[model samples]
Target chain A: MKAYDLSIPLGPMHPAFKEPLRVKLKTEGEVVVGAEVDLGYVHRGIEKIMRRRPWQKAVFLAERVCGICSNSHNLTFIETLEKISDVEIPERAKYLRLLAQELNRLHSHILANLALFLAIEHETLAMMLLNVRERVLDCQELLCGNRVILSYNVVGGVRFDTTPSILKEILAVIDEIEPKLRRYAEMFEHGPLLRMRTEGIGYMSKREAELAPAVGPIARGSGVRFDWRMKHPDYVDILDFKPVWREEGDARARYMVRFDEIFECIKMIRYLCENMPKGEIRRRAEVKSGEAVHTQEAPRGDLTYFVRTDSFGRIEDITIRTPTIPNLGAFVKYMLRNSPTIADAVVIYASIDPCIACLER
Target chain B: MAFPKLVKIGLRQLIQGPVTNLFPKTPPVPVPREFRGKPRYDREKCIGCGACVKVCPSGAVELIEDPTIENPKKRKKVEFYMGLCIFCYFCMEACPVDAISYGDEWLLSSYDKFDSKLIVRDLPEREQS
Candidate 1:
């Protein structure tokens, strides 16, 4: 008989993942001993498509890279081009950008935790989290026109400007979502079932996280005090909150970090709503031949965009590096090394917040 | 905190009715007024400069030239294949003469992709506007 008695393949399409990602697990009875991740199921050829289009049209193409964190991709791409062109946006536009991106992070973190709950077989928690996410989405929709795929960021500034009434409504949304998130966090913290399933399961030590070269919450959850947002000058000038991290390096630790992050996002949004500067939202970006690299802390992690344009401001070449490459790649290789049970593996995968569309793009 | 989270949620569901709205059975939750849904066209304002034709990222907006007409001025026309429209409203934004506006129409489902009703076409050029 084989030492590893059986191999079970889980999904290019699975309930635990919203996108297609296949993971093959080699198991000895109920415990998984080894695993292999498979990609390339959802190659949309978006990068190749972006190169054919100029920056103006390509911003929309960038937004399509990930439905969940569309604004991050759009913002990063625009900033890369703008840096080369030396198009400085107004202060109000920077504040508006902060509001939009934080709301984006808020909803995305909630959704990631919702996935974790669903994978752990807690349907009730998942459904409730979906409602909380909808409120955050409404706030996003109020500021920007669309819910999921928003081309809110244009060449010089944002497309939509916020009214006083709009800021008031966003504040109201945060007020409602706060209590619900707090209550749920308390439930998850004290709930024996969640703790039993998540605590000390699928551990990613600080060393493993550094070795994986993980960024954003995945690295934060594993005790690394690294965040790309800290390096972004605009973020430092507008928002004062520090990045949230947890030391446990397990499924529970990862989700706890998300809960804290939701609160931090709420704080930043509130500050922006109160102190939002009033000014013109946009300016014309002149087309220039130059190259620049820009990185934005996306909902999943650090997303980098490198852009080189011709003398006419047409995109000569553009490259995007999404965090899931290092983050999820490490999860499959290091974190999933010795899974105790089938259910634990799913929860662990869900906890890392794998954005496959962004990864494969 | 709710000691048993499930019971607390179940009780709330018992009181607050269903979480989801009755969509398809009823109207969708009203979107904001600035919604760029159901795009409309005004032929009088269209100069046929092809700004929209160039700016449309989806390539949904087309400048359909009337080969049947010999006059170059009257030959050029605009038609919106709404099926291909991503509702990004880039065409409306790119219009130099303000030829397009938001109609606030959400549902665009039809059995035929190129149904005549689905297409927002330019009216014939007023002999000498």
Candidate 2:
């Protein structure tokens, strides 16, 4: 009997894959038969950290889970705390939270898709996509003083209020960003290099996509009309926007769906910015003894946060289930049969937009 | 036919200038006046209120009080450690005096681990213009 062995280590610190998941592929003659994802490098025991911190303080601390989806974690923490305490967030705050969360989605998906483009060797297209994404980053920095971690979400409401001046700056930025983004979209649609890399690559069938616990673009790209904003009308009621979907279950479809969603986010932000309610942005509430579960769709997928508060100020327990876990599962499944080479396997992995840091946290 | 075509492409490439930026040799790009970069601390205006230290998520800033300064009215020394900084700019935002502002210099790579630590010394009363 003869056996052939090959092990390709992806990253603890890699540019191609986000959040440092070690991809160990067992291949036989350039065809990957199996792949196992190992994660522990970026784990900071955030749940343990949350346990030590006070309930109110955990809102700020939890946002550190992932820089890209910081606002999502903040929303999750706030919603969980509110549920546990049996308090309703003010209508205005809810609107603002939804607005911030959607904008985060728009930016994160673009960044991830662009990173995939870069990995696939569509350098020019990647640059164009990233350049458009810079507008979103700039707007975030101007709004919250940071591009990724917009520590704007607080327990009762948001810390920062958008005044006319802030709105005007945001509008000016969106105005500058939209036309450039449109050009990129046109270029992406027509670019042969983009077509060559992504068109038929990483193709996951509809049946497989349905069985898998996919969320966000991963689910939507497969023609599955499942958006949290649709099922939960609070997001739509608060922000007033429709969900975007695409039918093709391929890499290019995911790219197109994300591009379309960017416009939807812009419209949502514009509406919320224009019709911001004149009221107290935050509600006055204190954490009490109870337990509650909060689930929200992060940029990647559904983010579940479990919280248990005690009589004292400190939170007793907190557990986070990131979207990347299920997304990684789908990637492993697809790559096992589809990708024949190490590069192919890597490309398939990148397409899912895995956030290892979020998983580890 | 192919040889002549290759020569023409090669000659065109030779005439076109290099794409690489002359980084060290040339003057740095002019940062816009309003552009925010690294945070620089002006110790004179700082009241040692510790607002920056409290708001820092990464615990990068520390308020070091000096007992040697006898006058109760005089402010104590507060040192800054930029090494552990997440560059969130919360310290500058929380500063009541607005003594700290963004600097355009972002070349913060240090050969020695301690060199990245930016410590501001308090100027004498005479030096305070």
Candidate 3:
């Protein structure tokens, strides 16, 4: 065995990644054979904090798991509380829930793709982030008055209502934004540098994808037809859309899958806008003492929340598993074959939109 | 590659305007009204509710109590530490008094950790009822 000291520390810095997860790569020559990740940097003891707070208040705490995936965490925690007491939210609330989730999916996936471009130092593509992200941010602000952390989802209902005016404004914003989005997607697909860098690189075979336990774009890229949206039909059954998947399992394939998912989300959002059911966005329900499991396919992958409530209105226990945990495994596998540069590792990691804070929680 | 096609790209760069603005050295480009940047805190409107303190996920806000005040509620103070602040703006959402507002001070940097932490007054005496 040839001995070589190849250790590179990625970051705990505020700029490198929003969340803190230090990537320590051991490379033999230019190939990374082994990788270890450290994630204690951003751990705020969210679970422990949740255990101390009331279950109702815990919804707000859980929603802070990550700014990009705020709605998903908000939904998961609320859904767990609803399940524990066997409370059913109103029909209209469910529709709004689906709409918010899909919008979040669109915003998160696009932002992730933009970040991947940023990591590879594609300034032209990276500059597009400001415009593309602004659309979703405007939509989020119009709807909930906040862009990054939308504190809309309450216990049994959402805080904001999709009034006629709000709906019209949302639709108008989407109309203005969609053309720019499509143009960027076209640019991404045909861009020479983008193609050269991402196409057939970081290839994860279907078997390898399944074996690695990655989900969302990582799994869908490998042709694994697994999506929590399909699995849990109750959440998205009424929404008229299908899960986006690709067989290539390369970085470009993952990027394309994300782009296609945005279109699907828009379709679902439009459908919800046109045919929004008439009912209260929230329902009155009692928070009971019991243990319950909550699961939702967040933008990245299956975000699971386990909650146990005490007789008092406070939460007894809370646990979360973010998508980054599984998707990160794919990097060690793929980077082993490539002449891994620091840039390559950064690109591969950014491609998954790894949220280390959520993982540590 | 064709020579004309190659020359066209090269010549265009020579004749074309600069791709990026030279900051500080040249005049700075004006940002839009809605640009997202650093946050601002207002003391007058603040009710000393401490909602901002509780809701800050980053533990960036610290409430300093004046020991000599007759009414402790009226003497509450706050200091913001940008070092730990994530810029999530949860404090703005959680503020009942609407004391905290988002500002355009994004170019924040400091050599010392203590210098980076901003000390903000939570609520002045006149604001208290």
Docking class of 3: incorrect
Q: Give the Cα lDDT of each candidate.
A: 0.84, 0.74, 0.75
Candidate maximizing TM-score:
1
TM-scores, chain B, all models:
0.69, 0.70, 0.76
Candidate DockQ scores, in order: 0.54, 0.12, 0.10
Better of 1 and 3 by DockQ: 1
Candidate 1 chain A weakest ten by summed lDDT:
A330-339
Query: Where is model 3 chain B poorest over a 10-residue stretch in terms of lDDT?
Result: B118-127
Off by over 4 Å in 2: A1-15, A28-30, A231-233, A340-342, B1-129
Position A50, candidate 3: lDDT: 78
Query: lDDT tens string, model 2, A1-361?
Result: 3244877677766677655668887778787777778878888998998895676557667889988888888888887887777777677777777767767877897888888887787777787677777778766766655667777776677766666676677778778888878877887767787787677667777677777767778888878787777756576566554677788787778778888888888788887778777788877778888888877878888899998888885788889999988877887776346775777776777788878789889
Residue-level lDDT for A228 in candidate 1: 83
lDDT by residue for model 3 (B2-106), tens: 589769978997999886667777876443333344566776566677887887766789887767667767878567787677666668768888788756556
